[model samples]
Target: MERTRRSTIRSLAALGAAGLAGCLDGGLVGSVRERGGDGDESDESGDGDAPDEGRGPPTADGSRHLAYDLETLREESLSGGVGTDGIPSVENPTFVRIDEPTLIDDVPVFGVARGGEAKAYPQYVLVHHEIVNDVVGGDPVAVTYCPLTGTAQGFERGGTTFGVSGQLVNSNLIMYDRATGSWWPQMLATGIDGPMRGGTLREFRVVWTTLGEWRAAHPDSLIMTDETGYARRYENDPYGLYAPLGGYYADEETLFPPLSDPEEGHPKSVVVGARTADGAVAFDKASLLVERVLSGTLRPSDEPVIAVADPALSTGYVYLNPKNVTVEPDGDGYRVGGDGVGGAAESEGAVDADDLPLERVLAFDAMWFAWAGFYPETGFVGDHTGAGYGR
Candidate 1:
């Protein structure tokens, strides 16, 4: 009888609505709503207070505006199976040294290091729990992932925590702060709905590369383990496989309609997007492979930024151009400077390639449709000539 129930659940998972309902019934979906009243009333007091209104934010008008079009924000498009905290955030996560036998090298991982502490978050685990609230170098950070957009970014939490709002703005994760109950869209980094509306969060740099690449770059780094408090199928990816055919990743059609037109690159084309105070630019991953390195001054800003690709990992990174820095293929990894930057196993300290002295602007990998939807006027660089991924 137990085996029959498990089989039924898997079958429903493949069937959409019925699958979602089953997840809710099994308690896989968290139903915790905002405590207190409506999430309005300004939180300028900064005492981590909840509003005395109802759930959600005040209606948007000229006084309160969103970065994206309010009309395009389809509230009904939210993934209902997962409620607040349904996909739990790792509070006090454990990590293992890079050389630890538990982790395989080829699996993709999001790597972030600061001061001296480096940590790797595996995609397999992030596929289950999209947010991981952990502290590094004495700073509170939230590492987030949106499988739909293929984006992994880190943000400074400002003494607060973030949770999955179970909402998607343009198929991107919508995060809410536990303290203010404000809804923040992951890619936009702005609080769209709540007292914190129009406010932005500070972002940190996180490299999306293979575990082997990160391990080779930061030998002393720590890798997040599978010991999350929740019982999850860490090995099973609900979105399909990574290599060869990337499941939804390999599809050109977006799961939901985007605010921007899909006439540019294919919907799922992967691009390394960089944003500055002035403007934004996206470098096609496949184009970077052919060019090896692409760099130039992004319009609006005279300063230059460079994009480099790691073909082996099918990942790329964007950095503010450093003085005399040229990214070239260096064995299994890419070197940022004339002075060789070795792999993590041989490196003495955290890999500084991703952290040049210049300010590391906020950048992330995104599906073309998602990035273009958020930044329609964004300038695109690179040859986009190949067949492109997903399609």
Candidate 2:
């Protein structure tokens, strides 16, 4: 997947937190007061109905440890100014092929492929709606993006859709399940203030890459269209831009204060992170794109995990490398052979960066601040920031 070179764009405009939040504050607060109210509902009780086992999204056997307790998280939650459902989820999203004129090569998009079905959710379109409740490869899924935290993720939605809860904690979007009505912080995915408390939702990887890179890798993919029922300025971004970097994305300030603050790197520096029930690891995305391979260890156990860059998609993949197999850059692919793993120590062959002979851990791109706020003790590996690979 040879991707086209992307020209970085400069910040188109400077916006303060007040200005940014103002764009959304109370705008359409009532028209959509339709769902949960301003998230200020006096329900600190977490008594939302416990839906039938299979009626909600699939839950993980275990979840990445949260640094804070449920009560503390609830205490930290705040409104994003918009009322519930204010930022609507696209219930009946429509997608089109590459033939669409707006599907340009350098445009940003989040790519997800499953069961032979591939879809590209354009960042411009998603920033306006945040969550797109759609089916892919016949499986119900929710594709969500948070402008404030700079994260995009996918989740399995068994029998219910996810809607924005119009709340923020750690400066991350909080999502609520239409079925159990559980409040889930987008980055955490685990229920915090509802019946689903402590339950982690199943997640899928989302590649934050340019449209050209994705189409090159998945040419026959369908891309989200602005045909969404809502009318929005898909071309405008209230927080900031990314191509050249501008606005809140390039600034050091936060719209809402985070739960925890760590001064490791630029708050908005992008890191490709992967987390499991045991721990989390973050690889400086920029460094991986250049260095090709960055190594780190999970906390407490010192379990080794390596990240490999996929030049084709301008993204990276994390793998559990207990054997510490040697993975080196080979043209656009990678070579894995060492410790008597993939092959003899002296033998090596090119393999796609996405598929090593080791266990692949789902990883996605996120801002450094947001990753640290949630996984405060996460292992970080990169020359772009401070430490390489623990609390």
Candidate 3:
């Protein structure tokens, strides 16, 4: 029976809604004593305090507001059926410099450029193992991806590592820090359960782009290899392909019901989302790239911000524009500051889209449904409603 299941995943052209849950099965997990159970790794108990910085993964100073009650999310969670560590994380990951002449140009990679250190984690490889624990720029970090939500994210792993909790909330991956057994949903990035409840992770940007584009931008970049010590086929994507946009990714139906049903936008359409202490906001990625710039405000607070597209990496960056500066696309970069904000004539300069003069807000790409599910109040900027932030 297991053999047939393995064959089905290995041979399927694209995954359907029903095949989503079973794709990670068919293989027995290794000894639990190796990594220990979720409880065995616990280092603290729930005390209504944040996890100690020295013992737990580093957390953000301020927690992002959650649209739902913590207890409500805990009750709504469902088991993914792949017990803890079933989809293991890549610890002591191996990497090699990606030089020219490689045939893997079109492959998609999650590129992270931190403090001049550039490294990429391939989608095909991460599809088998959702998390890769490695050090980038001398900081222990965890690079994560969720196939169901089509989201990729980065977090600082101070003294400990993270693993899959074998659970799903709003069709997103639930990551548990080994130090406190805190469950952090990838999209929310807040601890929903365990000793670290109410804690928020310090996040970094992970650019989603093709290998060829990344290599072109960062010539000295290194990419993770498929030597994760796990016995699995990395070539076969369990979900589907991103380039051709096939399989479960392109499907309109979600495997599980969403917590909040958004009235507008496709469930699978990609949106660049940002969250601050004030509130969360999302911009249509496709529109932002073409238009090169989109402006919106973080909810209730209504703090002004703008989304600038980086054509080089095929990603977008959100910047806080309290001054309401006008940022327009030049030849290849952006022209910022003029009589744009509040009708005030300000100093103008040319800057790269990724390196705007304003303060940048941490943002990442997420499926519309996942963003809406976790942040129902998120202000969406798209073609229908022109985001009139005075830009």
Candidate 4:
């Protein structure tokens, strides 16, 4: 997919670890609290289900309010799983799936999709919470994630380069990060209906195959990250069809993290810059150089935090999953609309699939409110900060 020259540039400018340190620090502490909370109340214990210890006070149900489990959400086909009829209603009604292991540029990655018809989520393009909470129908949908590469699968959908935060939120096909155990749920707001419409065949597997091929080739790409950081730069891509109507920047760049042993702790010393076409350039004339990592150009390092290429996912109109129907062949094609959150959210004024602009989309305030109440841990952190947080 051709990235909007402007948005691409903005993405580079937006790259920084300022808030990242805070987010990551808070995220880790939050993970421990939430996960620990689960063992005390619930029986299931896994990364996806790991409770947010740092969030809100425990609900009566004791669920940490997380989207999905990272460790336990094994890849499974929806051939005969239970339908959405029995699933309880959730504020953020995200769909979860574990897919077959596929090679990308010889690197293996897992599949994880979240959200539905009302939103579109791009993996790595817009890095915010490890979990994604989007609106589907009118309900809140949270998606838990873990990804091998920092980012993966740069693709086009509906003629737009969907490298934005919420473009594929409701699309069927989603991707996962193998290393981090992250799941990326995708859906298109332009078509289909609600969460009940979610099925394995049409929505899930289609994207799996597309990203598998891309991962088999491109391995050294940079996924999107938080644009609210100090050392970051975010541009607007005018030609970015997926970007909000106003357009975005291009020729984005950022200083890469210095290489170091995990035990030694990486220093914020080195400076690296990555461009859409020219590729990555390091200030240090010659360190270990890699090209098109996502495209699978070089030998992967033992180092966990290595830069890789973006998985090239396909673009075009994606069909929404039909709701409350048996999984069988239908000559008339799949039906659209159902009781899923996508439909409900659309009915309300929270968000509009057809009209959300890129500028608004890129604005942190606009997107943050969408899932402000995600994991209980986030609530806990906010409270802690309000009470006087420690560095």
Candidate 5:
């Protein structure tokens, strides 16, 4: 996975009908070790204070807000003309490539879909994996991916401070084909759920290099979102019924902590979701909390939203969401490609409570990918590593 800082947000609006569990307090076996506790059978004790036991709302210091410039992050990767292959093309696209295509288990990865198409998920769409540990304050959160509501503009603290939470997840910016307005979703699941069917893969279209430019042009386009009413929303999903699609997982200690004050006494960055000695996987609780936003319980108006920042090159330590992204003079932030996304603009659409196709959409995640992975004749796993991975 591409290395970046760890940052995050908190919400549970995607669970729909699943009743918010109140503050995500279920402690994980990993959190305990990070807090100077035990990571083994001790977690089985079910102590209310366990890291896997979930946490309460954040405090004043724990909340944050974020904003960025637009032009700075906008780099047009596409030529000034349409593709020679007759496929759609966006102005100055910033395509994300997935290297080394093959079967993670058995599923064919192919390539990924850009932005703007029905069903955010497409065959071979690369995935981003982010593990959250700490936020602005000494709080914890988790990093999760969903394609339903689209990425939140940013996180907030104390109800007003907004923080950036896009880069690390890589699901924030979405692509839109200037030719066809069809919106294609990226595939989050890697393992072969089953064979690709006819219409199942038709919703996606291939676009040339320009993933970044497309996002810059259509600021309204959403990349990923959080879950708001997942339990009930996915209860009837065909994927969920046949093979469970979206859900939560708790791992070992957080490699990164998304610290509010990186310069202060903070933990160093580690590979996200990496396993430590003793066979335990490193992770963060803050990431899980942010993911709960898809639980149908979090609302857009919720106060003190939590978030993390993606460190440069998987340093592992997570920073507070607003703390990580340093917007440039133009109000935009910088990533590897110097592409920055402005604050999220409100999308004009009514939630289709009953029309969910993939279980992740119900959780509000955005999707995007490079054109190399969109070919109908291509197999899973091409030249990109983003496929089958999670952000």
Candidate 6:
């Protein structure tokens, strides 16, 4: 597959003294040196601090892992081209209202909204700068995108900041925190190395959708501008066109092997997964497209979970099914209220008829192989069956 071929080429290109000289001229090695550092001087951890002690293997509840072991995580992955701060993060980024004639309608963007504040981060911009440290809804948030994994997520960083660690585990971007100098895998959201090892990050929902759909949902939303301090081609996508899902993203193979074997589903199939205190569940995107709404009970606790697919955004949200409300496709939005409240409009305001709002559980979208590799025993809620790891 194209993905494997790309990986082989990159691996071969990183070998030998001639390859080292070539890299020095310009390539992955040079890029890593240019970007690999303690980030800004202000954020540097010059003080001597020992790395965190290693822990036991990941739990069997599909919550954790022992992949490559924490001690060897840094050395296990490719290093030359993966440069820290190589893709400079946009600090205190500027945004314009959605009605402004800056961005086209069809361009793909990651949309996030909270406390009435909404913003869009374009894929073209994120493809270069994978991390954006910005404040939203009076909270410090980091908007991150991994082109290789096709994962876009929002993380609450408290008062600290995050930078690209110039590393990849399972072909996914690894991030480092400025305060603790700890390494965090983007999808896992846990610290694997340094002072903050075993710590978890608070995540927020980021809708992966086109600009047109986001604008319709949030007319008053703000869009990121090209006023970024760095100079580069904003119109050009280094990973290929994503609006139609072509290029590297469309391939069914991965650039690097994952720590755990991928046993179920296609390598590139998209799935919306949610993890609770008990276990994790993954809803197939293809199945969601057909059913619109899927309801199931998570393992170990039998806690009810609901997945509602939004075709307009090309994303799905997983929420705890506490109210037991049946969801159906209603015009542009969804009628999530009780049975009697048929086709109720969100503006009509009948969502609170039961005196309880739908509690949203944290969830994010990932490729099937990445998801299965991380949570091998995860339950599936669509056409695919649950096949435990190393099948």
CA lDDT scores, all candidates in order: 0.61, 0.71, 0.74, 0.20, 0.18, 0.61
The candidate maximizing lDDT is 3
TM-score against truth, every candidate = 0.71, 0.84, 0.85, 0.20, 0.18, 0.73
Misplaced by over 4 Å in model 6 are: 1-80, 297-302, 322-358, 383-391
**How many steric overlaps are in each model, in order?**
8, 5, 0, 126, 167, 0
| Residue 308 lDDT (model 4) | 20
Off by over 4 Å in 1: 1-80, 295-306, 309-360, 385-391
Name the lDDT value of residue 76 in candidate 3: 68
**Per-residue lDDT of candidate 5, residues 79-141 (tens digit):** 111222121111111222222222132221111223232111111122221111112223222
Q: Between candidates 3 and 4, which one is better according to TM-score? A: 3
Superposed Cα deviation of residue 376, candidate 4 (Å):
24
How do the candidates rank by TM-score, highest first?
A: 3, 2, 6, 1, 4, 5
- Comparing candidate 1 with candidate 5, which one achieves the higher lDDT? 1
lDDT of 4 by residue, 70-160 (tens): 2211121111111221111112322322122222332222232222331223332233233433333332223322121122222111111
Q: Which digits, one per residue and each the tens of the lDDT, describe model 2 over residues 277-370? A: 5567888988888899999987544678999988888888888888777888888788887654454343347889887877787788888878
In candidate 4, position 193 carries an lDDT of: 22
Predictions: Cα RMSD each: 10.6, 10.2, 8.7, 22.6, 25.0, 10.8
Residue 269, candidate 2: alpha-carbon lDDT: 80
Off by over 4 Å in 4: 1-19, 22-119, 123-133, 142-233, 236-391
lDDT of 2 at 330: 83
Better of 2 and 6 by lDDT: 2
For candidate 3, write residues 1-391 as lDDT tens digits.
Answer: 1222234345443444322221111112211111111110111222323434557776655556567767677766767766788789999898889773364687889999886699999998898888999999887889999888888999878888999887877778889989888998888777778877777777788888889989999989999999899899887886766766777777776666677777876788888888776777899888888898999998756889899998888889998888887888887888887655566444356688877877787888888877877777779998522211111
Backbone clash pairs in model 3 (N, Cα, C under 3 Å; residues 3+ apart or in different chains), count: 0
- Which of 3 and 5 is the better model by TM-score? 3
